[model samples]
Target: MGIPLDKAALVGLFLQTLFYGVFLTLYWLTLFVLLKKTGIQRQLLIPVGTLLLFIATAHLILEFVRALEAFVFQVNTLGADAYYSNLASPLALASLALYITQTILADGVVVWRCYMIHNRRLLVAILGCIVLLIYGTSGYYVVWSFSRTHPLGNTYISITIFYTLTMLISVSCTTLIAWRIYRTHRFIPKGLATFLPVFIVVVESGALYATSVLALLVATLTGSNAQYIMLTVIPPIVGITFCLIVLQVHFHVGGSPSEHSAKPRGILLRERGVRDTDFSNQPITVHITEETEIVQSDMMRGKNSQLDSEGVFQV
Candidate 1:
């Protein structure tokens, strides 16, 4: 049983590597699409993408090291119990930390999006901050538990529960963002040919990470060995979900009729200083008067997804 468990871990690690390859490819394509479509804003985006790749690569390398430790080092020395025992080795600690960091960072990005989607309302922002604080605090304990060189009693289980909470925060914020975006998109009068795809991409991307986390949460709660496999797969998937959201938004919005028609269905970018991520944090409103119409139109749009305030079509 011990030998087979070790083998299962090894095989899981191998599959994780293969998954990494697929995601790495998507990351490059995502980066390229982001740069090409994002215009000057690529400065902020490139750094985020680079960080994602760096974290993802670190996860793979650290996991590979853990695999070696479990299979080669332990087998050659202390036998299979060493493989099963939760040794607080450097490689394991680093791997654990990397996974935690990836999940937290990805959640932060989604929370940021949620903040913006809610029009940067102080209430939403405050709630997001609270979520981050809780997530960070819980994650600290998780790492602290790992520092003991092994999970003491139910320490690992506690860590798993905390991790689930962190993921739930993501799903909650994602739901809010999606609902907000959907409500806003209901207003585009014509040539919505663009926003629908963006909407689908956003929803699907959110679903991607949401589903992964849900599965992760379920596996952890069920005490299945498959939890290890899910953990290995999640970091890259989170990174991919985020990049795809940014990439798809930029791709569809960048190539919209705004380029050819010179007026992009009345949607005009709001003047906000230094837009973060793909777009500004304010919803783009159309060039119109009539407060009633403006209010109605505003309900149908989101910030930073239109031409510059100067009326220049970016890219």
Candidate 2:
């Protein structure tokens, strides 16, 4: 809780570097998947993802520079505290700006996903944009307020509100998306690329990002030095979580031949329907098929097996 500011920054920088490596790997993988699987619509997603990665890169580089200034350049002369505590320094202000930008972009992606999945409902879109507006406004105010040499006591409350709104936006949008996907999963026929996997991906990715935000919020409220570490790691986590949803959803929809062959033999006879939607900012095509045949004989079948209207028979 009382960790030295310089020490906390050092740890945060180290952890951010590690997380950035993971984010880099996932970003490249996402690119590979999108390029391989998507068509012209791929343009819709790549720029946003690339922007996030770029911000993360800038953030890490900035942290490295700041760390150098605090530990190496300033330590022997002005002392590390001088560099670490000065919120108005160019590096300090720039770092906060990057964090806010990354947060806004990441939150925008989630809201976009929500809008698309909800059939582009005007209400959803409007509300999401409104909240995003509030989030960005409050976030910048917090940044500007903190940069002041003598911030008022209410500045802490503003910071708390900023993070609270972030968590709520993520949770609410994700819940809406998950609910919509769940409904679609229930209404649609089974054995034709189940939506459950998509549901799981949405929930997991959402939870991962939300939990990181919650951790940071907790640390901030508690006045723990760990907030520095949490702050450093969140940018990369946002990228990582988004990339994961894209990769995993890509695999579930149509993965490599080996991944496909690993599943039980099932013949999809006819395409019933296909719905185009956006997932984690990527275009996803969902195929609904009718009449799937599982190629397995009844070796121990005292009960007669027959295909039902839905496709498969019970044992």
Candidate 3:
């Protein structure tokens, strides 16, 4: 038999709390790295990242409130089942809104990063448009689904589509970004191959998020109460992925050669004025600050190069 909804909800809350702690640490670390290394700029990533963290915070608070109501206050009164089954509860509605909003925003950021990294290629632009449309429409249906007395019976297909599209968005964006990195890697000087591991780590980190979403989709489609746990965990997982990219880029860009001396000869060529043949023709302004720099610089260094005699290696 499936796990009881009340018990599942409680377990989900516990797991969510654990992940939220991790997310908090990473988010603050990202901010510290940015402010310490690169002062604030016009980078679009700051506001977007802040907004996502805010949504996650609100979601966690709401989840705690719901759990309290279900297990503590309502348990002896209306009963936990009554509390969990009441889809119209303010907490439930708010949680749904936050979840959908985060989903759209997170997916949109991934697409935007891909579009920018590829120099706004028409193909990426078209894909981004399609992604936003699906997310927007599916989000609307998700909200609508809740209004139905029997949402599972009336809107299961819509819900399924929403999760499936989210998973696709994650997988597609990760694949495209990884491919771009791999292709760009071919043009980089052999001395800079040391950075390849870091790049690969970023791509693999993204793949992990995609995998998490896939698991969520599977659990959702299987009608497993475990979906509750995945749902609760996703917000933090998203934050973790975002922070991992930011931190990885920050460390490589700001780190000293002595620290990486054991690794390879050309750890970061930025200080050495080494320009790849592919980037010699491009205009490069090196900015080591901001989360977007991870994509705009490290991922596509050849297209974006340094112009100063100071020997600032681009990317």
Candidate 4:
């Protein structure tokens, strides 16, 4: 007899599903906030945000299908009867289609953003061609797998390859951009730098959705309830936790003032005539002192001076 899902496993699965839904919603909301806050050109974010929105929608659809499947098959196993009854459902097929579309869109967005940021036009074109090839090949494999009732093997391999490539490209681009920005800017604002790593992790981890799909496929193939529970519960939890850690790190790093800013001398200088040359650039010290009846030789020394109320020489 096959191992059946027990009460604890059922509860665990329900909680995992709930968390997945909540996280997906949060991801969308966060993306919107970033879109509003980012100084990067609006055109760039549009494609990225659209891709994220589509992926979130796909996950929601997948969750719905899983919930419906659980309700019918788990609650009324005898009534459902068919081993692959859920597979036959229109909603299930629609969810699968959406998932595939989401994968393509996600990969495309990553490649496009990377190429755009790097100004690598030729490489971008090459990546675009690669995406098309992978997507087409994956679609063919998926169709063949479904037709032959062997989706588990073929779909898993194709999706994994696609996701791995996407993750590699995105991470490389993000790290390069961050490093370049750090090098070029004298003082990167705490807020911006803090926010960047979090953004990268969140976006890159979107590929975890593909991992979850592969896990589900494996569980289905093996008919293992334990495998299903493990696959469904672990990846999202780990991925989202990493995202939250990145966010927390950003908030702390960006929120706190630098040691240089916190110095006693810096505090005193703030009140003096000295002021930051450019608020956005490195802070430079400017000393203002009083000078009366400036000496001709000193004046000829090419040093600039300004007179103050006190009749004293100041430079």
Candidate 5:
């Protein structure tokens, strides 16, 4: 018989798989609720969010399979070497393809929306075409890399460069847009502002890169099953946490105030028309005085009595 699996390793594997599944479930449920309530059917962030959810689901499935293989066969067939050489190759390629497609399309839509908002039709078309060309070329390269036997080196370099450039461009564009909105609106919604800072930190800190590096170091140095389990578990937890936070912020920002409040303030406007056309205009000033102190003309008193009878005016 091959080496028996450590009890602790088995427990960790089970818990990790369970946690991942829970995370994915929560994410999808939150996303569904947000979509229904917000009525924002199409957004760049939706695809990104979906991709993240997909990654988490796929990761959980992969881990579950590995755990089952170990438990049932009492063999280490799904070890690091097997993962890197066989399983990861195809998965990585697919992930890269999805990332490229989603990123390009999402970013293109954002750029197009920005241009349309600013009434830059000509520039929108030009920039849109350029985005398509860049994405097309990248897709071609990714397909070519996948077809080769030794695809890792070329694929890694291509994806790294593409992702780095895309991240930088996205960050710069989004920051500029946010700034423009702030300048024009004077008040950026609190949730949206919160999102920007968290997003900036996640991108700048290179959380994914750090996770990969830590995983590699752990796998190489100790070669322990516990380490392997921890490596698989931690990054997804962190990623899922961020995704949930983002979704929460989005939902909170999108919520209608009236829906949350029982007694919403109603706007009550009292207009005095100087002329027929002036009826459409708002009053320039409003003054409140005690009824005891104010003296009203007979005509004004009659108008006030009429208004009070109709319940159209209030002191």
Candidate 6:
């Protein structure tokens, strides 16, 4: 039989596949909900977002095919050499390539966030570039190792180093961003106050990914196939982390105190000798957007109320 179904490697991969499906579901569902709020039929359906979805879908498809071939077709029909060769096949290599792409893109998103939070600082950008080059080089080495006769024996050390470096970059950059946000805003909501040591980012993003990468790296170093089990789920974790950043930014709270007051209220303001603008003539979307923010102002029949709180109409 080609690698027994009950083997630790197979069982670990199976568990990972199930978790990957869960995270993949979360990614698309959250993406759709937030993007739908942007209106305009399909607003902000950007290239990076679309590419992430494509990569995730393609990865799942490849996993399904491989799983079927192993557990169904080759369950009792292959020897050891064929089993190992099957793993290093072209499709398997392509799958690893897909994972590398996903990691690069996810890391790019994290770096972009640091750039944005730091207001596009040149030094930060340069540092980010160097980190990415190192990460990419290491990632490529890991893939190349897969073609070797004994991939894990040849590459575990490098894999450990790669994930270690990855976790370091992720932790350091994320902490910097969170610290800056704290210095600027003075406080993040207590509800989102999880500033974990090495796995969390601003707004509690990316902890799962960082932690999983750490676990995978540790497993690799310990000379176990547990790393492969974690690999199946890491892509989806990366995508989910990227998606969480977008979701947090999208649902940011905005409005005045009275806008969020317990009492439902509206306002109208006018000035004497001023032309009355017909806002109703504007586009429906514009009007809808304008009305999204509740106005808290007082009406003045014949006097300027720009600073005065008299003759207020609460509608």
Clashing pairs in 4: none
Local distance difference test, per candidate? 0.65, 0.74, 0.69, 0.45, 0.46, 0.57
Candidate 2 vs candidate 3, lDDT winner: 2
Off by over 4 Å in 6: 1-13, 33-45, 79-87, 148-154, 187-203, 252-315
Runs with alpha carbons beyond 4 Å of true place in candidate 2? 39-41, 189-193, 253-315
Compute the lDDT of residue 231 as modeled in candidate 4: 36
Full ranking by TM-score = 2, 3, 1, 6, 4, 5
Clashing pairs in 1: 88-149, 282-303, 283-302, 283-303
Per-residue accuracy of model 4 over 226-297 as CA lDDT, tens digit each: 553543354334334333433333243244424323533211222245564344456676564442112233
- lDDT per residue for candidate 5 within 1-315, as digits (tens), equals 322235534564576677667667766765675465432333534565576566655655655565555555535655533443342355445543544454455456445534543334576457656755675576558667776776666664564455445544445444544443333222222323333443443243334433443553444345444544544555355445434544543343455334434443222222353222223356544443342122233224424332111111010
CA lDDT of 163 in candidate 6?
Answer: 81
Q: Distance from true position, residue 195, model 2, in Å? A: 2.1
Candidate 6: C-alpha lDDT: 0.57
| Residue 172 displacement in candidate 4 (angstroms) | 4.6
lDDT of 2 by residue, 1-315 (tens): 398888888899989999999999999998886676444326656787899999999999999998888888888887886787787787888888899899999998888777765655799989989988987888888778877888767877777887998999999998987676554344334423545566677788889999999999999988888898888999999999878877776666443435544655333233456443332466656554332212122111111321111101010
Local error of candidate 2 at 197, Å?
1.2
TM-score of each: 0.77, 0.79, 0.78, 0.50, 0.46, 0.66
Pick by TM-score: 2 or 6, better one: 2
Candidate 6, position 158, lDDT: 67
Which portions of model 5 show Cα errors greater than 4 Å? 1-32, 35-56, 59-79, 86-92, 95-129, 132-136, 152-156, 187-256, 259-315
Predicted candidate 3 versus true structure: per-residue lDDT over 19-109, tens digit per residue:
8888889888877755544322115556667888999999999999998888788889898867887876768878877888888888887
Going through the candidates in the order shown, the clash numbers are: 4, 0, 2, 0, 0, 0
Comparing candidate 3 with candidate 5, which one achieves the higher TM-score?
A: 3
Model 1 earns a TM-score of 0.77
Highest lDDT against the true fold, candidate: 2
User: What would the TM-score be for candidate 5 when compared with the true structure?
Assistant: 0.46
